[model samples]
Target: MPISLDKVQSTAPGLVDLAKTAKVSLEKRNLFGTRAKVAVVMDYSGSMTREYREGRVQRLTERILALATQLDDDGAIDFFVFDSTAAHLGEVPLDNYAGAVDRLTQGRRMGTTDYAGAFRVVRDHFGFAPPKLAGGEKKGLFGRKKKVEGAVDVALPDNLRPASEPVFAIFLTDGAPNSKPQAVQALIEVSTAPIFWKFLSIGRESFDFLQQLDDLEQRVIDNADYKPIGSIDALSDEQLIDALLDEYGEYVTEAKRLGMLA
Candidate 1:
């Protein structure tokens, strides 16, 4: 079971309502009582400066933390901020998540976007092995030309490590990655594990590259979902939660069917 309602009210009174709404959202998706490790990965690139300053990042963090209170056994979400590099900001607990965005990004300088670097950090943090990249040049995440800087390697069959639970990762990015091939390869590798990636575009970008995750044939499972948020402020809590969790229940069911989770 998740954290009790009594604890939520006492520890983080502001999130009490949001947590209640999340419970209802989970019930609607038939994911009530589901237990998973929660992660929120934020893009700390130069383009995201406006959003961060406008408090949209903080708003989203609070919302995700509220949802995490219901899904994660520890009532916290592992947090990461990334750009050309990735930084593990540690866990944002239900009790101390109010100013997480500002607190974590206070002294950090925004860098160029590097989705693959951030993905690799998450993969390693969760104990997944690095995936081999096939030698080839492919369209980059921003539609730019880029080389996949590695030798061709044969894809292996699914030999994922056994785990008792799944990981729900919410990745927020405003634009395309510096290297699309690396990002794709990262997803392919983590697909074998029990981690589901939910990529949310926090800007007006189409995120065409992310949409391909549904049909990417290199993975053992469909482990990702993408949604474009034109404006974060426009969404009510319910609407935000719905978009964030879209297709997640199905992903969990499929993971169990494939023996990724017991």
Candidate 2:
């Protein structure tokens, strides 16, 4: 469900500033030309009810979609919502903004946050899960399976191939994750993969766990960063974009240095 030009013929009236801000910041940091896959993960806990009700999340989606429309040829974004568990809402085309947010708010069933579950959903959706061997397939001589010699590589379907593209996951939350240990481990595990997480915190709660993401040791690469944007009502487009991209430049440079990007 890629966003077609007709679906996003015009920007939301209130999101003009955000659209402008996103375009400028993304271009300045060279993110627009990176050709990365984009996904948005929203926190669907009870704490986020207020923000969602006030249309803050909707506006934020519009802003991000603006960036996706410019950067991605398909103009689509993989959208997910998470609380106790994570679920993919579906691809959000530019025209379906309101409907997508409505579905997220009305269909949420969990009341706690689990960042690990959210990450897992994204990994599975993108087919990044480790390949599993078939059951009862015993290895014969020289550690090779019966008649098969050497390692057998399975090719993924075309749709799944996008999983290999560098991913920029935008995680929106209001507080610290309930599953901190699992969440931290997930971040570490995905550090070597082609995914970078950008966490945006809403409200005034202390995201102590998120703040420590950059300092996590022994990671193959620093793949996550966080910013606490107190309230959506007070956020100007410039402020929002600035907060979201605060560490993006450094992340890109590191990814390139690691040969994760061309």
Candidate 3:
């Protein structure tokens, strides 16, 4: 059966409350005080089959897209799916997000989960590169051009370069990562950049490894945080947003103190 876009938009349960809570959360934390970019990175491995089929992921995506519409001027979100590798699903418009989420979940499932791959894709998408990292320009795994020039720009004074918009990446997963060291390394490299990673664990799985992300050593800043949501249906929209952003308020406060985020 075909789903009408209007019906999908009008019938989404808790959407209004989700949007309201999202706005309140952002305002309370003073996050993205200016225009910011939003991205949703979903784990599409076999372990996530049940959540996808149950429509939890789709509903969550819709709510986040609603948040994006309120926080971002463009009102669109960049979407990506990861298994052994990550694939960009393009920007989903707020008005047509239901169709986009449906299409994102309608694909072959990959066997393993690779968090590093998804982070790499996002870093390249936003043209972020670490200072003093030298390598010949090559195409990104997703076919986007990886320019070494972007690294040099990172060294320039804030006044010299164009103003940057902070990026909030919402990563949803259901299990442990296949490569922990690589994932930790990627997070460390982007810590100084204007990007914040909010990782949400779906279902009742033990996310012990993910919970330790904040304890990692030798980072410019604590750039990521994790929370487990046993069931999306169990929480009110406000509660859901609060759970997802539990650590984000402190992150933003510390980021400002360190002069990392404006």
lDDT of each: 0.77, 0.66, 0.67
Model 2 misplaced stretches (Cα beyond 4 Å): 1-17, 129-164
Which residue segments of model 3 deviate by more than 4 Å? 1-14, 30-33, 131-163, 257-259
Candidate closest to the true structure, highest lDDT: 1
| RMSD in Å for model 3 | 8.8
* Model 2 CA lDDT for position 83: 88
Error of 3 at 237 (Å): 0.4
Worst 10 residues of 2 by lDDT: 140-149
Residue lDDT tens for model 3, 1-262: 1222243346444355566667677678775344557789999898887777888877787877767655576757898888988878788775566767778656566678988888878878887655333234322211223222212211212432332456778998887788877776665566656677888886768487676554444345566777777775677778777776676666666666656566
Instruction: Give the TM-score of each candidate.
Output: 0.87, 0.77, 0.77
**Residue lDDT tens for model 1, 6-48:** 8999999999898999999999988889888889999999998
Candidate topping TM-score: 1
Report the C-alpha displacement of residue 4, candidate 3, in angstroms: 24
Which model is ahead, 1 or 3, in terms of TM-score? 1
1 or 3: which has the higher lDDT? 1
